[model samples]
Target: MLTIVKGPYLQWPTEDSMTIMWETSEQASSRADVLMAERIHSGYQGNYKKPEHVVSTVSNKGYCTIHQLTVKNLEPSTIYFYNIYSACEKGEIESGPHPLKTAVRKGEPFSFTVTSETGGYSGFDQSNGRINRNIFHQMQRYRPDLTLFVGDLVNDGQNYDDWEKYFFRPGKDFIINTPFYSCLGNHERNASWYYDFFAYDPPKNYYSFDYGDVHFICLDSTDFIKPEHYPNSAGEISSGNAQYDFLVQDLEATSAAWKIVFFHYPPYISGGYQVEELRKLSPVLEQYGVDVVFNSHTIVYERSHPIRGGQIDENDGIVYIVAGGAGAMPDWFLPKREWHTSQSLAVPHFVQVVVTSNLLELRAIDEEGRLFDALKIRKGTNGRKEFL
Candidate 1:
């Protein structure tokens, strides 16, 4: 029997392109049939139109179990429905008629969800698998156009089973429709599987993308990992490294209205795990006008007061959010509140960020979809930000 072992999921979405990938039980060739649509669901399920031709990949060794296809020539900020088919020796297998929307143009409105530290073992008494399951369910309700995963998707990136049980199986329904971008976490162990499964632009580990008016960057934070765990992975985000150069060049080039960066280790946190070395990048982040930074590792929810030059500067400082409660074992806030902490809690939750030309709103919701915190920022003349 022919079977789809994994995926039928989305990735690396651009205004005019979206990549669809899947794994089959046998070596096979694949095809994607796409149809452009106006609305998300037009009360029409049975309608079908001739599809635009898709671009797919076949293994260099004739045929392979994995199938990947990039659907192109799409219209920006438009809706499209697609179906995937895989052909093997036995017969043809089909899935979808699924809906996906292309990236919205600059100054347009869009939303994305954020989650991190989702890769811990359930039995570790640190993180619960049930919470991961519930959080994913809640994430789908928001219908985010994109998902920004801070890091640690599996307990052991080298262990294949961990990927399926800890990450994929729990996130299947949510991931299929929502394309996500992730950074590397310590728990990933710098394994080969991490690189093989995802697609990115050059220097894959640290990359950036744009949606609407927001410029989103995901950095590897390689300094956090021990040498033995990542023997051959030498990428670093320090001031003198290549990753640093990319950050400078990319930040200087983009003209997006809002800038957000994320990674696994925190430069500033209310907890004990803060990486003092990472403080060196703060100047660069501030210089480039990064609005917010998301970090994970410690399992706690923390949003620091906007800080500039090591002090709270509400008028112009960048906000740092530690959204580490996705599915990791909980970590406690320090015995004494830190000067930078605006709000700190140890709860499993996810954040939804809605961005527009002049405004951005963020809401943090727990597993049950109850909002715990909300923030709104309005931009005025001269790119000045007023936080409400």
Candidate 2:
């Protein structure tokens, strides 16, 4: 029937370009009709702008069921509407005049949501599937410019069906408009599908990008999650491999006003699961002045105090957050709180971060869409922060 089997979703946005990707039931050629708007009317009473036509570049060989089309020369910080069409034996089928926005320029304001661990495979009520819809819709309410998935997208990385059921299907609406960047988690099992589905820059599994004045780095921390792995033995940074070298270079090169890093396993947590090896990344992160780090895999929500050298340094230390509460079964916080824990909670939640010129605000909201924790960091001379 040449139906779309997946996404007419957005990804890897740039100030001058936006990439739209989708998969069709049959091998086909694709095209899109785009409309740029100064302002779009909220409902059916339509008021819009002229439409622009764009063609898709077939991304895969053979049938060409997958299509990735990058629309270029777009105006920075502008809103646009687009609809995709696929051609095949069943004639042509069309989808969405979906809305999207190009990246904002440096020093401009923007917001993004952070989440992960939606791969739970238990029964609907017991697994992440139960609340994923609610949480995703909650995220959509914030209308974030981007979404950061810290990892563990599915329970079994190799299981094709799980990706569809656990993530893509539930998050379709939110992801279609809000582009997302992701890392890997142990549950992903280092599978090929993870690479095929997400369209990121080269060396896909680990890469970095800039938005406004914030530098965002996504690293691969899955290896260290192995039960037997210990410090200096495994992990993206601790293994002393390409990823480690890349981390150093990436951090050194960026002069962004704020730096945020994302991975899977928690190096610091008050939860049951903790990977000792991931802690090896602290020195490097602090040395390069990373402002904050986000992680998932513990299935709980936690925020660490500004930590430096294993101690809290409110004036100039790095803040670590575990925002693994997407759709996984909630885990309890250990009764014995750790010294570095600033806040700990057992709930399925999402984090929203708003970044302006010198101020960053973070709010953690639960599945029911209620705020539970809030943090604000005001940047000062030489990148020092005054947290409130």
Candidate 3:
């Protein structure tokens, strides 16, 4: 049988398409059945109302066990029930009657979680695994529609061992059905391993997507830092380069109510690392009136006051949040610069963001289920944002 090895993780869910990705033990042909389920009663009885105009694309020929199947032409803002089917020389295997939700309509209210520095199995003992599970469970309780993983999903840079240890197992319950997008951290150092494991946007490691009233730009921070370590297309973040060029064009073109950017490093923070490439993009971010920026690599939790042109201006700048609290070994305060830091703490936590047509609410929750900080950004009809 085509034994499942990793994932069935949901990805890039849109009005008309949602991708289901998984890894298997051997080369195999795969298929999925998309059905509509309608509530009948208290016991959760629902009908298997089959969907039409659906397309499934699979690579049943490659020696690589990674299988990415996108179910296309689905109804907008709809609910779906699906089952995975795979065929191999050993046998045929099936998974789930899982429920999936498509994108919300524009102007609709939505919620999602943002976090990095996760699944550091080697960084902790068996009991630490419980801490990882605890943090993940707490976030899951919030029931986010999607999740933005800033980076460091595992401890080691390259290998299936690290993958299974830190990420695949702990994330099984929450990530499988949730649409998970990512940024590349130092831990995901191997070009082939990082790119091969988690699926993001097409062609390069950076890309933008829209859901509800928000447009999200997921970037790879290591692009300019370590060009020698990745593909030629991987680490280009300078001006006029592919990544920077894309950021300019992408932000210039987006008309979403809220624009949020995420990457692995903080250009200005008390993190373990900082860089020119990331700091260089701050102007670009502020220039476009990007609502907020999320970053990781510090292994601490910090939120800077709204900053514009390198200064805090509550009414005119974007808030930079450092949320490296996804189970990685703690890297405490390097040194906080008093001018911009509103709050900073060493903890394992995640940020939950709720977006509406007029508001963006963020909450930081720790491993013990404490809400340490909360911020609200109010958006006027003219598209200007201010802290509330």
Candidate 4:
């Protein structure tokens, strides 16, 4: 039997609750066991082993199944090494000895990595081969607390084989230890494999997670608003009403020092696509006071100036980043006059976000370990602007 494919770890509402996901080739056993250890060492040796935690079987597809195990009563900001395995009468198929660190208690500082546009094949010369290896290598070097993928996990969303190959072989090591979050891209519109692969609390395409003093909101932009729906009119943001509603509630409910949103498409991009296409959802994002928005569809690295209500506003505007270069080839498009794009680069890269009590630093790093662009956003006071 093929080994279990682990991936797409999304944090739960609380730090104690965590959602784990994995896939198997054939049906071996119905029971799966999760073991946790505290204060693990580098070489995977320690006296940190929690009692075995049994998870309930939630759903299953033809050869894929999803199991959710919620671990409660965990210490804040602590490291927990865990393993998952199939329980059988004769023996078991073990996965792990992997380790994960819980979110900081509150008002603490942390760091994470954000990347997208990986695991795809546009053509022969533009394959995402190097991007995959580079990202995994960077993960090993950085060992970030969390990882977020904006979209395009696979070239074709319906191709289950690609998903298994891309994530299982290349991304398994990072997913097992660090909690990876994901959003749906245009490529995933026709595929249901994402839901089957990742076990989220709400069982929806979009969700929110809180770490340290920031709230990360993952959005599904493809189905939420389609270009076809608005023929004579511009595009309408109706792909995922459930997601928009959730966003409203999630943003209002959080009092974090920073608010960041990650999605597949750019609301304001200088790419080949039309500009008015993003007008539909611009209002909602502006109303909720989103600090930064990270997007990845164009396969190019571009950053826009602060934008609010579809206009560039430096003082109280959201910083938009297009980081589609995870593994996709760079697009050769220039910025339009209306975009007010501050900086643009066609390099394939990923972003490293470092969060502190007073400020948030975002660095766009390319595959060659070069910094393409850097931005420092300071925290505001009582909804007022605060600058460096």
Each prediction's TM-score against the native? Answer: 0.90, 0.92, 0.90, 0.84
Each candidate: RMSD to true structure? 3.5, 2.7, 3.5, 4.1
Q: Lowest summed lDDT over 10 consecutive residues: which window, candidate 2?
A: 53-62
Candidate 4: tens digits of C-alpha lDDT, residues 1-388: 4455444243452566555555554454433333454444443444554434533223222333455555556667866655555543344466655566777866777888888766643442244476676766676567777888888887777987777656556766676667778888777664788777665545457878778888888877765656466212232354456666787788879877788998776766676443355556667777777888888777777788888876778778888887776664444465353455888777667888888866888888887778878988876676654533
The lDDT values for all models are 0.79, 0.82, 0.77, 0.67
lDDT of 3: 0.77
Candidate number achieving the greatest TM-score relative to the actual structure? 2
- Give the per-residue lDDT of model 3 (tens digit) for 195-273: 7766667754789999999999988777756646432234355677878898999999998889999988787566556
Per-residue alpha-carbon lDDT of candidate 1 for residues 330-364, written as tens digits (9 for 90 to 100): 44567777898888777789999999898989898
Model 2 agreement with the true structure over 215-318: per-residue lDDT tens digits: 99998876544445633444445535878888998998999999999998788988667766777889999998888999987888899999988899998888
Which parts of model 1 have CA positions greater than 4 angstroms off? 37-42, 45-62, 121-128, 223-238, 328-331
Tell me the lDDT of candidate 1: 0.79
Poorest lDDT segment (10 consecutive residues) of candidate 1: 53-62
Pull out the clashing pairs in model 1: 126-329
By lDDT, the best candidate is 2
